[model samples]
Target: MKALNATLPTQGLLNFKNLVYLDLSFSTLHNNFLKDIGKISSLKILLLSGCQLSGTIPAAKGLCELKHLLKLDMSNNDLRGTLPSCLANLTSLQQLDISSNHFIGNISISPLGTLTSLHKLQLSRNLFKIPISLLPFFNHSKLKFLDCHENEIYADIDVPNLTPKFQLETLDLSGQGDGGVFPKFLDYQHKLEYVDLSDIKMKGEFPHWLIGNNTKLYTLHLPSCSLSGPLHLPMHSHVYLSHLDISDNSFNSPIPTEIGVQFPNLYFLNLSGNGLIGDIPSSFGKMSQLIKLDLSNNRLSGIIPQDLIVGCISLFNLILSNNNLQGQIFPEQANCKELDRLLLDGNQFTGSIPYSILNCTLLNMLDVSDNHLFGSIPGWIRNMTFLRVLDISENKFSGTLPSNFVPPQIREVYLSNNRLQGPLTNAFYNCSELMTLDLSRNYFTRRIPDWFGKFPKLSYLLLGYNNLVGEIPIQLCNLGQLSLVDLSNNNLSGHVLPCITAASNKVRQEEVGTNPYMASSPAYMKQPLEFTTKSISYYFQGSILKYISGLDLSCNNLTV
Candidate 1:
């Protein structure tokens, strides 16, 4: 619903005097809001979100006149200036969301509390800075939801004395939890259901009292909260918690085998980035409703039980990378028909790719790299019609490429650092979606495939440290999206293409516009970009690789 760039004609709405609800959200409307907008006396719901509304709400006298307003959403606009003092006059305003704007100044939380009817208030992602004392002013008995996340609201609270009167259903303080500790006051609110205290810098045991004390909660996020000790879930607490994240903490404990029994209804669970050891609890299979489970970057070992997640048929993403987990990939996971993202890389897992995994046809991202896995590449991998990102690199797999080794939907292929001896195959030449191909440090012997230059989205072509012998294929110059090219330590000989040499010196204008879309994220994320800088193979990961493009052709028998 796009509006004219010119000022909104409040007079135009004057004719709709009986209008009870006016929603012009995402209308792309521009210019200062008209004070005359207050004329819409009957407006109970006014949503101008994403309308590109700009400038100050200096005199919202017209809006203030809407004493009957029940909901007003003006978020995702360019509105600035202090909220109008007249706003406190909307005694009937139940839900007021003015987040994600440029609004600034000391916003007094006390004035809004006058509208005792106010149940939800969202002030996140704005530049409002004020006293932590103003928090108490939000003690409105009816207020149930308050989100002041990602703001500069400082802390100066009397935690012990302040008992919130409202029974909050959702409270997301996360980065804005002013005080470095969990607000002990929350311990008094038994009605709190959704709570996010992430990055609060809390120490010691997990805040079991929070959940143990509350009746129930739907989501609890405590990532980077600096809490440590064994994670123990109260069996009687949180029977309805659907989402839980405690990543990036110092948790050191065996994931309780009773986790699934306790969180039978959990849909999302992440316990990554800790010192959790022992096998992934087989009891986790009891969480039949589990959708996403991330236990990556831990010290966990032991074989993942094939039936560990066989019951979680709804599971879509299972990430267990960077752990000490061993044993063969479980075929029981094939029962999860919705599986799309599977990351078991950087672990100690061994054995050939499970043939049964091909049973999960919905698989899009599969990573088994940096493991002890061995055996010939599975030909059935092509049966996964939707497979996109395949990383089986850094292993001892010895075999030649299957006729159709590359999945048609593949965006990135990481088969590097393996004992796989093979010649370049044209079977994957037509995989138009192929972007990053790293078969480096292998025994692959053959002239560089000219098809490398034809891959429309190919960004990083790393075939370095191979036994390949011959001139560098001039067809490589045809890759308009080529960024990082590694051909070092090869037995190839050639007069380098000027186009390929210019790549390391300056980004081809076409290449710059093609990279971001080359490899869809997660798979592209954290994938190392290895290139020789001053004769040293430097690795760039994460967002830094976006700007670091190079070409490594040294140590090759080839002459440029």
Candidate 2:
């Protein structure tokens, strides 16, 4: 049906009772059209997702006639209202999805045990303030899938202790309240797999039975649970588990070597933001199917095993930030040709970036900041055309920055706090898409580049504590998008341009906010992007991190 516009006539659809399938999804629809569709009693399949249908789905009025609806999808729309208990009348419903709506109010009248034929039900991403534990009923044998996540539903309640008659394949209860213990009822569910219990705090040891008992449980996530005590590596050797994330907890233990011997098919593994100590195990090398591996923000020491580079041939993302790792990065990393995003910042990694990095031509984001690396900055970095975000700050590297240093698609560059000395290169002019640039606390000589004024998206320009001499580049005033300007502690001798002052005056509201491009403020810079006042430094975050902007030409030979 050509239902692309709201002008489509629905009067004829009311007379068509034999129409068994009707889908008006992905169209500009109105409530009037929906009301006419309800008269078709033979509609076994009805899909109206993304129809831009506003207001609420009329409750228990016309839709109640579709007793033969086997599948009904009204997700991804503006429809909002309370839980419609009238859905209980659709006894033939095998699938009913109403996710991504503005539905609110208590779901107290849910006809749970009544719909015996209902199999798959989805009500995720709604505004309903209700208890999640009361969703499933024990007698519902045909019900296989039930998802009611992210609806403010798991507030203080206890899951029923009764044994489930249905064997569920997926159970997601993320962001839930305290569950005193692992639901023992799931122990009987050997067919259980793909469970997500992330952000759900529970008291006691890790649920080892989930691995030792149910070898079929493949995709499991228990992050941010705050569960205490040492870690326990599962003894399962034949399980084909592919995805596992137990990050952001107090699991104090060394990464077990048996991980490679067990889950050789692991595609995604994130154990970051935990208290994990000791070395990353060599077993990670066995994960040839691994695509992403993040063990950052922990106490893991020692070097990344080179075997990982060889075994995990398909590895793309490798984030090992905020650890105590001490060693030179291996040049063989380039052997993993599919590697893209590499983050080893906030560690003790020494020596220069391996020249082998150039072999990994598809590298997108590379951050090795806050390390003890010391060497002349590599010139070949300019050759990585796909490189976007590069941060090698807070190191002892001393030398001239290569000409044409910035890649075309580069968004952010942080070469701050180094001994680098030379004329500030105009390579930055090539970064038309640049949003942030910090070359502060260095010995860069010569005048600041005038081409900076030509940048269309430049917001931050920090070049403090340098030997840069000459007048304050008045051309910089042309950057109307400029927000933060820190040129303090330099040999600059010129009038403080009034346009620069006006640019700084447009502070982006007084608040510390979240940056969309970054995980947190610390990840964006070696330290908080600070502004000094009276020998004290205060930092900011988000798009307004430099919102309260000001020219810091302090201790400079500048005139008013």
Candidate 3:
């Protein structure tokens, strides 16, 4: 039972003498709900996940007395303290899940060592300090799945190379363990299908042998692992491999040319934030099933392969920013109909924005800033009804913005440092959901629009370094959510509105879950919003952006 706000009486539960299964997940229950639960000795499965339970597990007679229990799940709760030692009495337990809790203590001294019948165990996101060697479970021959990520687990160099009896199918110890070498026991784990060792400080070259050994492996994540050298793939193709991420590592070589052939069925691939160079392999065009591809923040050169753009028809999110890649954005034959977010900022690309991207009508975010592209801003951009963020700043684009430029659902628009010149249009007047609007360092000439106050959710307003001349409008004070305002380098003449100052002081609260265009990964919104203060430019994004509050009226003709 879930969301049954009513309190469960301990006496009423005791009446079920033959209750084999009982699930009280996501239910509000009394603190002493489990006080008399052990009396029902026939309980085989007990699930109390997301119950908001707190404090330590009850006494021995409460839960440990359920010797017949085969499955126990108390995950997604506020429960803390050490696991009861008496839990070993439940010898029949096949599955035990206590993840996402505050439970502490060493796994070796816990009751898990004695639970030989366990087939699966989840202890992730806790305070447990388990040994990286996994010596405690060496005798568990039947165990197939074990997840203990995001804990205080550390490496013990002195531990011996005792082979584990069980061959795991899925093992996730990411975001745990101390700085050391890769786990030696994995050398014998040939049955592994999914493995994640991300955020663990294991300095070494990529383990090419691991993929050769575990041919069934489908998902392998080793990001931020201090890994060095070239990313080497096994000589033989791995047909089952799908998701592979080795980002934020020190891999300093060109990507393997046959990567697409080795893993042709890959659905998601991320190799960003490395020192990899050379051109993106044309073999990537072979992976027709690829959906999300990220190769950003690398030293990769050469133009984006035309075949990869046209071949990957199922692509959704493509990120190739901050690279040395040059040439036009995409080939005229490019047709990625399912593309949602595309980031090509901080590159050496030339030529105007291509019309080939029009096939991606489902676009949500498009960023091509800090490039050498030059042309008139396209008016067809307004046709992207699902678009939320549009960043075309720091380019050579010249000419007036399209009369109907604003998208209906646009939230953030960045058109700064361009050669565009004209009066500010009323295209954004109906954009009530707009949050950020930047038009700085342009040749636009006109009075600050009073209609800007009509946007109920607008937070940042940047219109600095323009030829506009007029009095600062007091109507700006109507924006209750306004956090940062910049009208600097203008010819405005007027007294500063005290109401605008007061509104800036108010803390800007972010509407977290209300975003309709939220991407599946945080990489989609990695570009920061730039604002100058005290003669220094500051970049803000994510959580830090909400805390920033300031006003810039410098280099202007404003009066006291």
Candidate 4:
């Protein structure tokens, strides 16, 4: 720390009278020595974010001396002090950002409200509090952007005269100390482009004008705000509301058939975690711009909308799990050639999976588990060369798994509780990239395949309640990644390999544990942690956490 402070020769730095910008962010600055830089009288912009500095902010008399300063950014630092009151003296200051710092004490913005040139004020992730009846400090007409989220500010917003009256476009008040009905501030801001008021306990029906008149709004996020009742959509067609996310609320009512009439430009719509019921409107098929749609964990029922699958061709993700949708699989599922993720688990969809979707070359995940799906597993599934996850568990799939069904790139395969009756040689030999393979409760009658050792990446292997006889092979220990092995209730009659048992625990703990690739990787490669917490005693986190079978695995003798 001392080395960095001494390296900045104070001699050459003082004579730079024409210096207009000085950025030393992500540098190893020590202590509260920023006041020394204020000596550069002609400095217009001073940036010190992400610097290793500490201690309270010093008096800003030297900072005020910079009469030509336009912007001052000290964010992402360890600076912990009451905001300097002298900042108001910088009449030329247009933007002030002190976010992600350790600033403490009440943020007295009354001095800032008087700054006629202040256009942007970023005091987020700090410690501040204002009266419930008083509005946030933005009374100046020049203030255009105010980001005070993740703070301790609690106000019911009663002041009508405390208006900024500026052309503010973005206001993020998420994670701040706020409650009661949402503020009627948006009713005034006609030019707002982005607004996020999530994580605040603001309740009441969805505002009519927010959906109706905020035509220029591109992003509208109000998740977990406890807003209830039918979604009262605005009837304006010119409003290009691109993203509409109102998930995790108590809004109960049928999904409006006019959803397409209002949010035609919506590319992302998440109406999950609600009490919404009725079939998805076929009018939603008109939203050609949709890329991701999540309607999971709702009371929505009836047949899945075939129009949605056929219309939105640009879609890549579709999560409709935990609903009451019935009828055969949507015939238009093949239309989405760019589809990468298809999560339709926990529903009542029946009939065979359309082999017509093999054209989606980029397909990575396919989860249709816990449904009423029947018919044989098709051999064309081998065409999905990039397929990584395929879970068809808890279904009535009969006939033998195809011999050419080589899912070399597959990681997880859950085909449990099916009518599969055949030797495991073909399935285990081809799925070399498997991380999990659960073929339990099947009618397969044959000696366990010795080729199982080929699956070097195998972690979970559940073969219980099968008609497999003979000694458990020690060659199975070749699976170094094997963690959880449930070989009980099988017709095996020999000593179990200690290495396999230990590796099975390693695999179980690892699969159930942490995959290091997930610690720092993309969302598709990552796994969510699942454990016993207080509020959620049996909570599970992850994209591929499945329940293959019950606690009991009887019917076959275990000679371990």
Candidate 5:
């Protein structure tokens, strides 16, 4: 006793009369202090975790004075110790956290069976590889939360035996590295609210009992666990489910159209990278509170429902690209006031671009390319001041270039492969924020806009296959940031607009300016003339259809 008192710091020993909590954690104390701690008879909580303390817990013959100790958190310390059989004497301990420590020894079951008052046990982040042997004592117990994650232990999940722990609500057995079919281990987890069994090797289809109607669970994340097969619809509807992510699995089958009805409270549903197919259920619009819906990279088909935008008013992200959908976009922005992103490319939709999209005040991205749309673009589309990206290329659009057609906020514009006509509108020069402008395959005529060099951010401009005459504006040659320019096959004269060649450092030349009619004169005529006969290729067949095949500006008195 005298030697123990000498090792104690000179200023350390304080009054033990009213000491209800003593936390000497991370203090690097040795086993010598374990036997001497018996002197503090009034301690109710002892936290000596991560203290570099090695050696097994001393024999419990002399430490019975701590009868009132209720909490002991000896976690994350160098306590290379064994489960002392004497822990059975600490019957009054209710909370124990011995995780993340070097505890090397067999976890004998006989000693822990008597700890009936234990309510919370955290033995995770350790090297304990023994199969869970506390199955016998858990019957009709008071354990509430058990976290054995990231441990080397292996054990078959026995759910029926754990059904009686009326207080048990959260069970985390993730990162155990186990393999086998996930036992139908949750038949009676009536009170379970959160279950995370991710990254553990659980084969076979996911058991339906984990998220059925009778279950009161709210969060179930079972990711990357070798679970396959189409997820069978749970017989019981999960009305309270809010967050569900079953990504990176082999679950094939069309997502049940009744999903919205089954999980009405679902807010985030991420089924990406799966083999799911079929059209998005219009019923999903019923989830009024859903915020994010990602159905990308699936075999989904059918036109996206306009009701989905109207119903999910709070949806911020909607990704439905890379699918086999075919239909014109339903033009309605009144219901999608908060729609920020709308990615609907790689589909076949016909008809003119809808003018109602201007109402989407918060729209940041709009990708409707690779469709079959026609007619002049509504002027209201360029008025979307907040739009950053606008891609309407690969469609059949015509008419004179609308003034103020480019938004100042637009960074990228891909209007390629369209039948747009008339001279370059001066409004485009005002789009100082433009970065990429691809208007190839259009019928733009006359000299290029003189203010093109004023754009500080213009880097790529592709205007191939146009009947643009006079000369490439000298202002365009002064654009230092212009990296790629394509003006091939045009009737451009005036010394070929110096520095406008394939050898130009920042320019690329390609064949352009195909004529729909066989005429001697170049297109872009300022004077209106009556056509005696249609061109061989019929450029003037439709309503003011002079510009065709990128740009059919032939048979007109246009000079350089």
Candidate 6:
């Protein structure tokens, strides 16, 4: 039973002589509940996950007496210290899960090595150090699933080449150690369906054999594994494969042109942060089931293939930022209506915002900054009612700000360094959810609006290098969440309001929530907020933006 605040009576539990199963998950149990629990020798399954259990597992007459326990789960607790030696007495345990705990010690000498009947073991997010060779579990012929990620599992120079007795169906050893080699034991694992070896310093070429051998494999994540050389695919198509992420690697080859034909069922693909060159494969259009595709931060050039844009019907969250890709932003035939977050910044894309993108009605965050695009900022952007972040800065767009620019849900608007002119309008007064408004280095000429104080969540306000003229409004003091304010290089004349200082001091003590748009996907578009402070321009993004508090009224006619 979960969410029950009732105290677990150890005496009452011990009276149940035939209690074969007991689950107190997410319950608030007394610390002494387990003192007499071991008396229930008939318990075959015990689930105490999220029970708020703390300290070490009792080693005396607690869990050790449950010799007939076939399954035990104590995950998501504060349990720590070495596994009790008496735990090895549970020889019939087929499944044991102790993940997300503070348990420490080496697994080689631990009780897990003796649990030969274990078919499923989850020890992830612990402080354990396991041997890379996995020699201790060689005799566990019945084992199939083992997840021990986020630990100190390391490699040894003398790792044995002995074959394992069991064929794993799922294995996750990601984030085990740094400067380690690829697990050689995987060569013998043919029944693998899910594997995650990410964040381990395993330096090697792409393991094509992984897909060739494990025909049933569906998910393979090897991001940040120090893999190099050409990323070779299997000799034939692997229809069962779906999720694949090999991002943040050093693969220095072109993406396989026929990758779509190879893993046609892939729903998620991330090959970002690699050195891959050549044009994006047109075959990607054939992957009808694809949902999220990230190919950002590469040397890939040439225009985005039109076929891929129109064919990937289920596609969303497409990130092709920080690449050498050129040509129009979106082809007229672009039909990916499910697109949500489109990040095409830091590229050479030309022309104004395409109307074809309007088909993506679910768009939330759109970043096209640092491009060669020119023309008036589209006013139809308001139609995308779900839009939260709009970044079209560093372009040659010359026009006045649209009267009804963004949607009411807009949280961040970055249009700095563009040719946009004229006064800040009342269009932003309705954007109550706005958090960051960066319109720096534009040609806008007018008074700094007093209604800016209407935005309750406004944090970063950058209006520097504009020609606006007026007094710094005291209404700004109403923004208790104001953290960073920039009104520099303007013609505004006035004494620095003491209330402005009060607002800044108030924000310093106040905690701010993360920008919802930027927080959506950690690997997606990270729109940086540029502000000049202390005569230096710094770009802040992600979590670091929250703590960045500053006030820039420099180069203005403001007095102390």
Best of the candidates, lDDT? 6
The CA lDDT at 129 in model 4 is: 55
lDDT of each: 0.78, 0.77, 0.86, 0.71, 0.66, 0.86
To one decimal, what is the Cα RMSD in angstroms of model 1 from the true structure?
Answer: 3.5
Tens-digit per-residue lDDT, 285-395, candidate 4:
888888999999998888877788788888888888889888765564557887888888889988988775676777888888889999999888888988887878888
Clashing pairs in 6: none
Give the 10-residue window scoring lowest on summed lDDT in candidate 6. Answer: 516-525
Positional deviation of 84 in candidate 1, in angstroms? Answer: 5.0
The 10 consecutive residues of candidate 2 with the worst lDDT sum are 515-524
In model 2, residue pairs whose N, Cα or C atoms come closer than 3 Å (at least 3 residues apart or on different chains), thus clashing, are none
TM-score (C-alpha) between model 1 and the true structure: 0.87
- Between 3 and 4, whose TM-score is larger? 3
User: Per-residue CA lDDT of candidate 3, range 1-560, in tens?
Assistant: 54676655557788898999999888866767666779889999999888877888886877889999999999998889998898989999999999999999988898889999999999999999888778899989999999999997677758775899999999988985565877888888999999998888886899888888999999999899889988899989999888999999999899999988988999999999998999999889888999999999999999999888888889998999899999998778886888999999989999998988787888888999999999998888888888888999999999887776868778888999899888777768778878888999899888887888888778788898898888887778788778788888888888888887787677644564543323222333455767888889988887676568888889888777
TM-score of each: 0.87, 0.86, 0.90, 0.87, 0.61, 0.92
**Model 4 clash pairs?**
483-504, 483-507, 483-508, 484-508, 509-513
**Residues 369-391 of candidate 5: C-alpha lDDT, one tens digit per residue:** 77777888887877788887778
Instruction: Name the regions of candidate 1 deviating beyond 4 angstroms.
Output: 11-47, 50-56, 59-69, 84-86, 105-110, 129-138, 176-178, 212-216, 331-334, 425-430, 450-454, 502-525, 542-548
**True-structure lDDT of candidate 6:** 0.86
Ranking by lDDT: 6, 3, 1, 2, 4, 5
Mind giving the per-residue lDDT tens digits that candidate 1 earns over 95-210?
99989999887655435647678789898888877444335544578888888777675555444466667788888766744454555566677887898877666546777777
Identify the runs in model 3 with alpha carbons over 4 angstroms from their true place: 2-7, 15-18, 27-36, 58-60, 425-432, 449-456, 473-481, 494-502, 505-527
